[model samples]
Target: MSKIRKKKIKKTNILLGFICVLLAILLGFILVTSYKSEQKESRHLSEIADDQQSGIEDYEAVKERAKELEEISSEEAEDTEDIKSKNTEDTEKTDTAETEDADKTEDTKDTKDETAAAASGIVCWGDDLINGEESNTYSYMAVLQKLLTDNGYNMTVINKTLQGGGTLSMMKMAGVSDETIQGYITRHQQAANGAQLNVTETGIRDLTEEQTTRNDMDCIPVIFMGYYGGWNHDPAELADQQEQILNTFQNKNQFIVVGTRPMDGSVTSEALDQVLSQKWGEHYISLADVTAQPSSTYEAQQAMAEAILQKLQELNYISKN
Candidate 1:
């Protein structure tokens, strides 16, 4: 063995040893760096998981709020609908009430107008009703006037009686004659024609003068209260007068003819009732066989007026109000 070769071998061994040490140190450093990087990655992943959980909680809270808002909105809409429906119904009811009130007011006004017309001018007539103080005559006139006023009719009553208070049969009184009857009828006709008179006549006008006077005042309305004593003897004239008076006056005048008094059941009022019924029809002619004279003249007139007023009411000439 050579000394130079031995020394070279030792140097090579030392160099090899240094190289192995360097390699071991490098491997150790690399391992430590890799471990540190892996730990940091694990921490970052945990942070991300926490953030995701928080996000899920926030999303759930938002869903609950949205549901609450929807419920509140639905309730508000329902309340508004109900209020509108009630308002509409109230408006309709108010309109209907207003319309009914207006109609009632109009009807009231119309009734007032009719009453005013009726009150302005009206005429009424009765025979024994206006004449004597001996019976209920004056009292009956007062009652008739009161009734006329209440019914909205202003009326004037005319009576034809001699100076002496007498019954409706005054024409046949002891001192009276046909000429006197004619004069009486003429005077009555003239009185009725007067402007102040509303034109109503009582008692039969059978005399020639009476006929002429009645014809002269043809424009005036009349009412005949009693039958003529000569009417039974002259059926033709009686019928002619009946037809003339009925046809002439028509809706304008009224005639009520009382037949001869029933003396001990000898006379029946049927004949007079039939004639009147045929002349005025069922609605206008009221047939009544008057019993003994009323206690007063006022009662008789009231009864006659009542009958006429009832007829007028049936005809709708006056309203219920």
Candidate 2:
């Protein structure tokens, strides 16, 4: 209880206080470093997503094409509703007897329209793209079919896009074996190979043509399977998965690849498209150049379909004549 003992106790307290302050400073530094690391990771993911939302270019061409197709569609609808416009125009000039004859002629035309010959069927397999979710307010495939038929080509499109399905379901629909389908998922997952944003595990696969028909050899398989790959996946990996899928086809000449743009509007795969072009030249198609709208619209769908039709003709799937 003397002065020396009291002084020793006070010095001990000071040393303990210093050690506590040093530990607190170290802890604070560690916490800040950890927080910054997490934030950087978050920013990286957000940056990747932001990047996908870019690449929407050449929008005026899409708008112009849409304007033309919409006008044609309007005229076609009027013709369908006013099939006997000539007779109506001449009704006031003719008597009741002449009108009766005209009615008979109109009846024949209606019958002919109702019993038109069956069209050559083209098969399309896709995901959300089928629903106009890709860039329009309606099924772009419908417009694609119309573009063919309205131009004197005898063709009908058969869409096999499942309403709420994914790639796995698409493969299953195509009669891919369970083992093969599983391999597809595995192949894609391996290709994805990222921290947590791999997309194949999140969505679906696609379909084919030869498997759907027993005797219809003319059916051409058109496939669009890039949504899962382009959504949150690395573009190179997406290209890899697409290459793997194409290799799975027994006869590469029998199918067409409708290249996909991610929902966020980025290009699906420039390298893959190049690879496809180098191999089969024009067997590949993409709507990215045809559209640059930030959102879907009827016009965009029509324009995209028109673009596809032009490509089909270029590729000799449809006769130029």
- For TM-score, the strongest prediction is 2
Candidate 2 lDDT for residue 123: 68
Residue-level lDDT for 82 in candidate 2? 86
Model 2 per-residue lDDT tens digits across residues 1-321: 999999999999999999999999999999999999999999998897776555233356677789999999999989976867766756755877678888987875554333233214566665534443442336677777767777987877776655444455555565546786666566555655854534444544454554443332345556766564432344454444444444444333545666555554445446446544565446666555566652146666676677777766555555523
lDDT of 2 at 230: 30
Model 1, position 262: C-alpha lDDT score: 25
* Model 1 regions more than 4 Å off: 1-126, 133-142, 158-222, 233-239, 243-267, 287-298, 316-321
Please state the error at residue 111 of candidate 1 in Å: 16
Best by lDDT: 2
Q: Each candidate's lDDT (Cα)?
A: 0.47, 0.59
> Positional deviation of 288 in candidate 2, in angstroms?
1.7
Q: List the candidate 2 regions with Cα displacement exceeding 4 Å.
A: 1-120, 128-137, 187-218, 230-254, 264-280
